[model samples]
Target: MRSRLLRTARCLGRDYTKPSAQALRCSGARWQSTSGREWSTPLAKTLAEAISVTGPLPVAAYMRQCLTSDLGGYYTSHNEGRDVFGQKGDFITSPEISQVFGELVGLWVVAEWMAQGRKSEGVYLMEVGPGRGTLMDDMLRTIRNFPALASSLEAVYLVEASPSLREAQHKLLCGDKPIEEIDIGHQSYSKYADNLKVIWTEDVRFVARDPAKTPFIIAHEFFDALPIHIFQSVPPSQPSAPSEITTPTGKHTLNETARLPRASQTNSWRELLVSPTPPYSNHASLGTPKSQQSSGPPPEFELTVAKASTPHSLYLPETSQRYKALKNSDHAVIEISPESQAYAADFAVRIGGGTAPTPTPSLAATSSSTTTTTTQARPVSSSKPEPVHKPTPSGAALILDYGPPSTIPTNSLRGIKQHRMVSPLSEPGLVDLSADVDFMSLAETAINASEGVEVHGPVEQALFLNAMGIKERAAQLVKRALDRERGASLEKSEGERRKEDLTETVKRIETGWKRLVDRGPQGMGKLYQVMAIVPHVPPKEGEKRRRPVGFGGDIVV
Candidate 1:
């Protein structure tokens, strides 16, 4: 942690020695606009109108609108109605890349279940952001191999917000079974297991946390999509220009001017906000460096520092000591995601026994899980004594995403369009927007949220996958393909074609899995990370703590 703080301090010292003069100039005024029609997307116009009326939008507000707004957000049914995941989509996920990823994840869940004494009943499988249901499908198919774990499963719960994606998931997981609208969101039964019910909800809170049901939750590539607020530590005000110094003795006055005493105030945190870029703007106009500019017209929006302290800048940074340590550092930037913290806290409370906490002020408007809880209150009537039943902490939440292991994420927001990086501000709903996850923040939140839960890893995806036996799995898959090719030999010409097809299949399998564990500069293994939150039962005397598989522990079974 100390090292992380030092790294951040060095980053701040290198990048931001002085307040950005251009950013300060852009504050408190509307950018020069020629006409509303000049805006690229419909949502862009809407945002411009709102900004014109209210003021500049915080980066978080801008991101939420761009990514989840009902008016054609990136994830919603926009004009083109495009997919957000897969080879054709803006970005491809681990499951879409290789089945081994989800298979290993399923095994990890089973390993944890067995290690935790294997609850026979009241076991639930839940996945947040179940994109196309591919990961869940792969997981379920793999879990079915372990009959004991599979039979103990109660139902599958999917926490998804996009209706279009939900429909896609339904088609993939429940095929042909008409979805019935329920009080929460929607419900259907799985095609894989007829008896296993599947429920879809717009929010995770709708899926009530039952202390009785042990939940194994999966959150892959989820936290990075959540909105984040960026704050910059600006040094206290300085003089407008070189000024004549006034002294009581007039000796230090006139041509012999001495430097003025700097203000007594320390550096203050200010939020960076989103505002419309000037009409006909370019990278140079917005002070965007050539390296940061994307290949397109200038972005419709640009970031500017707020003139005064915003609610988020005041509260979010102060919540963590990691942020507090660098508060006085000049021009240090930090990105905080309250919604991410809220979700982490919720996952912790669900796995362990704890009272559900109200969402943080920054998250109240964003999250629906506020006030939802697994713990229930018992009515008392001053009569017979009420029997107390404390449910033992069980279950685990696995989170895999991309971010720094221990340091706060800084300047990590990005945009993707057609698998190419783009300016996040260029397209309102057309481009995918994401930011780096603060793994340390998540671990801190989960630990603080529930006494019964403990966090681990956030190790690199390479280390985790290697620990989970991805290499062995890939070898088995390749061998199976070769065996199948040999067994299905046909006529001379057909056999040659079949051999080519088999070769391609083998190559795809090998490359796909290798891509997952690739250690290149932009490889998934190096960029992504895996973390787990599991029930923590204090070891008695010299007893050892339980560590889940892929996070340093071996399979119990």
Candidate 2:
């Protein structure tokens, strides 16, 4: 039997950017080369070269290649030299649609900050997917009203994964600086920084800024853009089947295969996930199966999908919720991104209180400790936090995306080109490829990431926005409009005339607000969702649950 995987990276040749004929053959049928115009996309060529060298690529790998590839990745090439998120872009986010969205979010952060009594250590104001910085700008402007809260902010950070987006963010946030002078924060000025304080990076993994400072993270329409791995659940092997192979020399060899993908239900295509690693002898795969073995429960297997290059799957404990949670049908698919999970873990660690078991024991001990626990108790930042400390760095993260609370995404993967939906594989890096964020996994990751981390409602965007007071904000704007539109008409019916004059402006304001908060198809208020994680400090006497503002509202709207 041949080696299941030939481990052929070097066979690709000295130049990894260009695909070689020998490497193309190594990629098998999934990646084919052609000297035609169809293969003109720089991203496609590079991806082909990558696959040729690496063999079949995982869904996440393919997505990363297409989205962030330095050569011609869609986002890397600066949104493919096209506008990607406005009336003129591929799609528009809520922030770009209206200022109300940002204002409310800003207010929410303020409420949370004040509720915590303004940490002396302060907090890092951060936003994931800042987009042209419109959301953050609006948020900053709104927060500036509370000078103390604004002052409490140590710094602002933007978790951007695209070079093009980072450049755009600098231009949008830095105001009048020349492109040369404003290259992602070469110089740091505090005054100019109140507006341009945000630091940009192509990686979200390091955006926590400082582990010592609590992070007020706003992830609007962010997680959905992260890459996910697609997995197809394989049925249990037969009672007396030979899932393993034995060679003629009496040496047992395991079967190993690289990334594989298949078309599935509409808008979804299943990709290679964890497959059971067959018993192997030396370094070769034995095609012969040992069917004459004893009959017992078949060997169990778990997915090794976190990394793209994992050659075989292994048995996971029954406690593993991922593979266990897959639907009964063979068509059921589970998408997981190790990067997302890792991001969650890193965030959780920075967040201070992770769900790790030791914290619970520590908590039990703290409740019985001699020192007063004060308003809130937080875990120390270091691996070994000082024994008696109060106000552990509490961080709160709000994730907003067009994803449901559910983990299983049957067909959430697709492409959007100029607002028109297109096949994900159609143009490769030419289009933006995204899938719904698995908030369930994210929540779990948060819980498992660190001690003291708590998860909150993965509520509807409509409810979240409404709770944030979009309606009140809209009304105030309308009232302002009425004043601006009211002319010097003096008759008794002048009031009616003024009202009539203001109707269009009120309607305009209402329309944009509706688009942000409405539950219907045209509105993003429902399809999009909001979830948050913060330190769970037990409420004091008369205090109720301490959820973020987006989870509930005092106002009817």
Candidate 3:
């Protein structure tokens, strides 16, 4: 770890000493944005002093500043909505591409509400981190299809933390109906002082309302932005353990060898010790209850034992060589996101009900089979047990991100700048860094927190959209485009001359949508996944969620 850090420092030093063309371009862009003012203002001097004193800040910190800095953060100083679209933006989100994404999402929530028996009388249609309100507009437009749903929607709660983005969202969502704001503690709907039927805020930490009464939620492309902590495994003998100690005889030995039994000869015995510390520790303090700290390691660390071998038996003469070979060979890669789990757990508590064991503890325990022996044997504590799960209002929650059901050997952390891939370690906060989410772990965490909080996906985005009928919708759009093109061609008496142009345009749109759903090489099919969670019973015996025709088993939930 020290060596890696040193190497990184050296590389950074070299890069700084000889700024590349890219850095020059970035500096030129910033200079142009700041007008003719010199770069060395008192504020700039203070920032430089802070950086010099603190060494290098984490990429997450830099990103937070860049995106939300009071005076110069990307969102604060510029019109991000306008800047973050088309060929000029860093990257275009699905909602920015088409209204279909948000419309289908709104419909999905309605389906979830119906599935839960539509019990909530005044449900809140909430969106966390609504980007530019494009989603909200499309969703409300679609909700009008079901007038009852549109009317029942007590409020459109948007939880956004950025003032600039919030203003943008507000502008996009402006309508005759009132809009409300709900702070963490003062959550009454009357705060808006109008006929406000909806609200919006970003991040769950700020919501201050009874989740049970308004159990509908939406989070599109929100989880991906949450900071992630990453750690690479260093061999136990690699001198990276925190508890390093020198032997009394003046000899140094790996900490694991001294602490763990020497008889454990298998290289598989090694486990990467990583903690989901700050930036990744969900919006709660680390000192919170185990349930509240759901985004960290499960209370206990698990260790698996490998098969033992005889000390001197020459079962295999090439033992050391073979051991070395096997040691380098990648086995299982464990990727964990305590943040995602914490969020899911919180969602479960909100929708399913306070971590209370539903009336029939024994029956419910038996049915869910989630209660531990200790929890089953002990009498339920009377004192409202510190909420095991972080609290949130009731609502359907959707997590869409990149990742697979099982772990992969290679790390997924990568950087993106101007829609191009770059090294995560190269430019730090100047680029976006992300890792694939472990949806399976997230589902387990949510279910364990509260029963009947159904976690239905880690489904491929392509499949989810197809299940929601994106393909047919895209085809209709393409047909309309073709028709328009054909009319233009006929008017110009260039029917045959413009045939190729029309075909190419139609192909691009069709191909783009296909790429959006594509999974393998040359497609985003497998790269992005969409997941849905709702308060409801699991599908009945042998029954599965209805998927769109032709998508088949690809849509895993």
TM-score of candidate 1 to 2 decimals: 0.85
Q: Candidate 1, after superposition: displacement of residue 256 in Å?
A: 19
After superposition of all CA atoms, the RMSD between model 1 and the true structure is 10.3
Q: Compose the digit string of candidate 3's lDDT tens values, residues 1-557.
A: 34534543332211112212221213223221122323312222223333433343333233343343333434434333345444576677777766667777777766665544554366666776677778777877777776566556666667665555656666666643444433331122322223434554333533433544655667676666643332222233333444555677775655565665444324332322212222222343221233324453321111122222222121211222322344434452333343455566666776765563221212111111112222334354435434433233345677766777544313554546688765443222244445667676667767787765667767678777877777887788789877887567274457766777778867776766776777778666577777766655445889975432222423222
Candidate 3, superposed: residue stretches over 4 Å from native: 1-82, 175-196, 209-211, 238-337, 355-395, 408-410, 425-430, 476-512, 536-557
Q: Residue-wise lDDT of candidate 2 within 253-316, one digit each (tens)?
A: 4433211122221122235532222323122111111331233222211123333214222222
Superposed model 1: Cα runs more than 4 Å off: 1-37, 78-81, 239-264, 284-296, 358-390
All candidates' TM-scores? 0.85, 0.70, 0.61
Locate the minimum summed-lDDT window of 10 residues in model 1.
Answer: 369-378
lDDT of each: 0.76, 0.57, 0.50
Clashing pairs in 1: none
TM-score of structure candidate 3 = 0.61
Residue 63, candidate 3: how far off, in angstroms?
4.7
Candidate 3: deviation at residue 302, Å?
A: 32
Q: Which lDDT tens digits does candidate 1 get at residues 164-250?
A: 788889999899988897766679988878888899865665666667778899999998988888999998775554445556866
